[model samples]
Target: MTSADGKGPVVVKEGSDALLPCSLSTEENIEGKLFHWKKDGQKEVFLYDAGVHYNNGRPGQDEQFKGRVSHFQDGLKHRNASITIRNTKLADRGNYTCDFPRLQNQTFHIELDVGAAAEPSVTILDQIKDWALLQCLVRGASPMPKVEWKDSSGNMVPAHEPQVSQRGDGTYDVTLQAAVNKTDRFRCVVTQEEIYHQIYAETNVLLPPPPEND
Candidate 1:
């Protein structure tokens, strides 16, 4: 069993698909070698020899992995045994191991983090008697996050002045302002893609008077 090279941690979002790639450096024929992929510390999910089968030599696979996993025979010829996981879930977070019978085994660790779809937070930038400026900050995301504002009635509330800033840490900072009296319930929704997964984070911004004004 030969280990894969340059394998590192992979982050994925919820409800998405991801591929765990692995390759061997050996020149031996992989067809005769028994192949197995399992979630480390979990049950074997996939195995193959001259044909695809499970650990028990059954014709079918574990129901939990039905329609969610697959591998390529040609890929294995090149010492590649990458597996695809469709509709990734938060529960799928963990290390995965690929082993070859009478050979070496390779391990790949995966970390999956689920982002919140609704996170409501507020930061008062400035406040006046009739008007105020507030900042709604949404953090920890991949790809690009979409931020939208909504009023209490669930109506789309256009930002009086919309401003967006990218943080050094790869997250986003979105700021929007509204009239103090017009404030009711403003919701901030953040959406992004982590790896091949879709994740989101959101926060609600409320406009209340400062302690001095209260």
Candidate 2:
């Protein structure tokens, strides 16, 4: 079997459905054959044999994946062993293996990466004199995220140390502050390198002109 991307980890956001692709490379039918899906080579994710499948009451499915996984029966004739995991969580990130125990013990490996991500909220907290204090907030993100300020020209803006806090739900809340002396479009970028996810929020700040000399 081969993964859909053929290479690299499959990236997905938390709470979203993730499709782990696995299909026979020879394009042979596998509807009547047996294939097993496992996570980290231990936990049973799903299994299929002939017409009986894990989702249909076949035993041995890991508790974490039970009632949340499904296979494409219509595609079985096409040799597709892909499975969709609904409402994916951060813990779903791991290496997966699809094994065809009936087909000379053929096995294929794939990596799954799930991230809890959200776009930061940017706003002007206060404005005094010619400069304004801008705030960027990212709430309820897992594995945390790197937050930074940037100008319209893509130049990195210097800012104070970000205030980070962990919520009771195991997610993180981040607050970043920057003071701008000129008018421009400022953006708050949030990146989660582990899952290859990135998002940003932008706001326009207009400063009043300086007073004229007497």
Q: Can you give the TM-score per candidate against the true fold?
A: 0.54, 0.74
Task: Put down candidate 1 lDDT per residue, 1-214, tens digits, no spaces.
Answer: 2224454555565566767766567744565566677775465667777664653345556576766777767776777766778887655665667666556454444433333232335666776665555556554443356665656666765666656666564445555554444546555555554443332223344455554843
Tens digit per residue, CA lDDT, model 2, 1-214: 2345586778788988999988887757888999999999899999999989887777888999989999999899899999999999988988999899878888888888787886688889999879999999999887689999999999999999999999887779999999999999999999998767899999999998888999
- In order, candidate lDDTs are 0.57, 0.88
Stretches of candidate 1 above 4 Å error? 1-7, 54-60, 104-128, 131-214
**Candidate 2 collision pairs:** none
Best model number under lDDT = 2
Model 1 TM-score? 0.54
Clashes of 2: 0
lDDT of 2: 0.88
